[model samples]
Target: MIQSIKITLFDERTLSVRFGDIIIMPSAKVLKNAQYIELGSYQYWPVLVPRGIRLYTYEQVPGFLRENPYITDGYRAYLTSRLCIKSLFILSNETVNIWSHLLGFFLFFTLGVYDLLAVLTRLGASREDYVIYSISLFCFQVCMLCSVGYHLFCCHRSEKTSRRWMALDYAGISIGIIGCYVPGVFYAFYCNNNAAEICSSPKQMAVFVDPLRHSCSPPYDIHTFVWFGYCLQYWRQVYLVTVLAMMLAVFFAQIHPHYLTKKWQKLRSVIFCAVAGYGLIPTFHWIWLSGGFSSDIVQVS
Candidate 1:
């Protein structure tokens, strides 16, 4: 009697897992709703378990991980990982979220490098040492970088940890979104004190771009004022305002409530969906602003 794994579709996109013995597959609307069907001697089966999402035949999946499906062992790992990731971000727990954000921090670091090198070529930076000023952009990038990392790693934390990490994660998102527009705002409006500021600068600076693949400079005719510290100071203000706004929205809604059991799962889903949809506004703004409705530059994603 050789033992083998049994996997059956439980819904349109889920699986009920059994080691052996029983065969039960019902068309249930609620996937992962915890309905187990056992048959045969029901004792013939070595051990029965529920898999999730993708049903992987033991032979198909990697041997080391084949034992763990979306449910069962895999589910626990997923839960732990998921919880930790969310938690770390809220509390600012400083593991995966922080670590992941750190990765983004480095990316902007490189972008600054490019900006600095480019400045060196063009007669060694104007007043305010625009080359070093690239650090401001880097700073904003850092915020986004941290936010992203938090999102990934916060899943590993305990409940308390998850709450704090999620808050921090929200803060990080606020920071990132605000940061995204800082460089443009600073460079665009630094000079013309008389007129309401605009972010045409990012587009303007883009003109300087040559080795386009590597160039990080903004395009169009951007001109920062000599008094503005090359626009670094302005972005700091942006960060403060953005963080505040993000905190209010995230907390006020009680988005990450206590006890994320099956009950609140759907609520979480809705919140996430809403947040994601809201995020598209800026994204769409960026593409629209960048392309300016230029059919050539824009493509539907």
Candidate 2:
């Protein structure tokens, strides 16, 4: 039997009612034309859904939002913060840019959780491995989120808001680069004698454990562990420090007033390219250290 019924109206002809255990909603036609629709309810508040959100042409947007002349239509501009967020659901030119990175954030976040729970645990990952994986995946998530923020809010009425998000996007890129370097450097010099020497000082016969050694035994008589006597530890530190310095330099450079301006566009590309290209230096050095291209380590890597 139906007890008491309660009804809430979102707009004309669009109402939701609850009768005991049953819920009733408005028809799809009414919902389509609803003036104020409730997306969902949070703990204490209903989520606001935008109504009659309008799209504009490239020329209709403000100068700051006119970065892409090729994209002539379907631009959302002159929107308040609330409206900017609502625009996430709307179909617009920036929708791809926004959703792609948003999805990327979730993907990396899922991978991080999986690695920590299953993959890392199965491999008997050390404290350092856990830390490295966490940092790398976290950086990736940050990068994705920053990109999503910039794309979503770039349509804000205030140019200042958009520019701040852009700066954050750049910072996120730098962080992601650092994440890549951490794991790559750690594993590349995993068995380096100099690194082992530095880590376990006064212990000449230290048994340096390589995580990869647990899986497949190498062709060396030293069991799964391979001995290396090169100064790779020095080069490893040098590469990391160099990358950090370069990232900092790039970060500070973006602080300049004209850094984001179209006038310095090519210069910005060159700067980022240089920073990324610097990795090739240590890569080639590693190949050389491992006895060039034909070596077993080089081939395996």
Candidate 3:
């Protein structure tokens, strides 16, 4: 006799599976989760696993032997690559990390649009100020979105692919650090020094910009300063601080594995706070040196 199976939908992304002598209710959790079955009896059926399914040891991770020595054997890992982007919405240990940044991207995006429109619609808003604000905002959004992708897709089938996502995550960190510098540097340069004279310098160059720039009439033109002139800005000091901060972050990420042991797990949160705090050092230093903070620049930066 040929054995048969039947499936019933519990919801849009969940269902119940009935085999010859067993009935299994697969939860929505199976979205990012993996499952299994008896080798010979159900060789043709899909294995529907629940999210946070089975915890995997470093050795159990194919190609992970001889690596991540610091990691202990008490963590969950997906064993298969059957699900692609669908896995992103599923709950897992990485669920918080992924959703936090994804939501943050939306927050920054909304703020960027609102602020940009506010500046352009105003009668006396400075065009340079708007450009600086937008650059900073765009950089922040890219970084956040990249983080979302990294955390969500880092569990792909190929270990090599997972490593690539890690690289992208680092790139996002670098770009975010650079973005944090743009406005802070621009404002400190023009606000504390000679704006009119610097505007006329040969360093200012015109470039293609968003349609939003047309509202200001000339589009966007950024002043690419000379090495000496650029170095003079207080934000460069901030950039240096940021570089150090990023280096520290990368060091922690590489040397200390977050998945290693429960005792060192808190390092993840510490690293995040430390990088953010380090980025603030230059801002505070500038405020002290400049005698007071420029509300406009500080607000955006």
Q: Give the alpha carbon lDDT tens digit for every residue of 17-108 in model 2.
A: 78897889868765654443222232112222334455666666799888878877777777889988888987778899999999989999
TM-score for candidate 1, residues paired by index = 0.34
**Candidate 3 deviant stretches above 4 angstroms:** 1-59, 63-82, 191-301
Prediction RMSDs, each to the true structure:
15.0, 11.0, 12.8
lDDT of 3 at 97: 81
- Per-prediction TM-score, please? 0.34, 0.68, 0.49
Candidate 1 structure quality by residue, lDDT tens digits, 1-301: 5377666644434555564676555356444443232222222212222332222232333333333343222111123554433333332223444566566677777777776777555776565447226535644674565466445543332545445555555545544544444444434323333222233344533442223312222333323322232343454455435534653564445435542456766765775465445545444544544444453334432
Off by over 4 Å in 2: 1-49, 192-227, 252-258, 262-267
Give the range where candidate 2 is weakest over 10 consecutive residues by summed lDDT: 37-46
Candidate 3 lDDT by residue in tens digits, 159-257? 665665665686577567767777665655443245335445545312222222332323323432332234445556556555546654554464343
- Computed on alpha carbons, the lDDT of every model, listed in order, comes to 0.44, 0.70, 0.56
User: Ten-residue segment with the worst summed lDDT in candidate 1?
Assistant: 39-48
Best by lDDT: 2
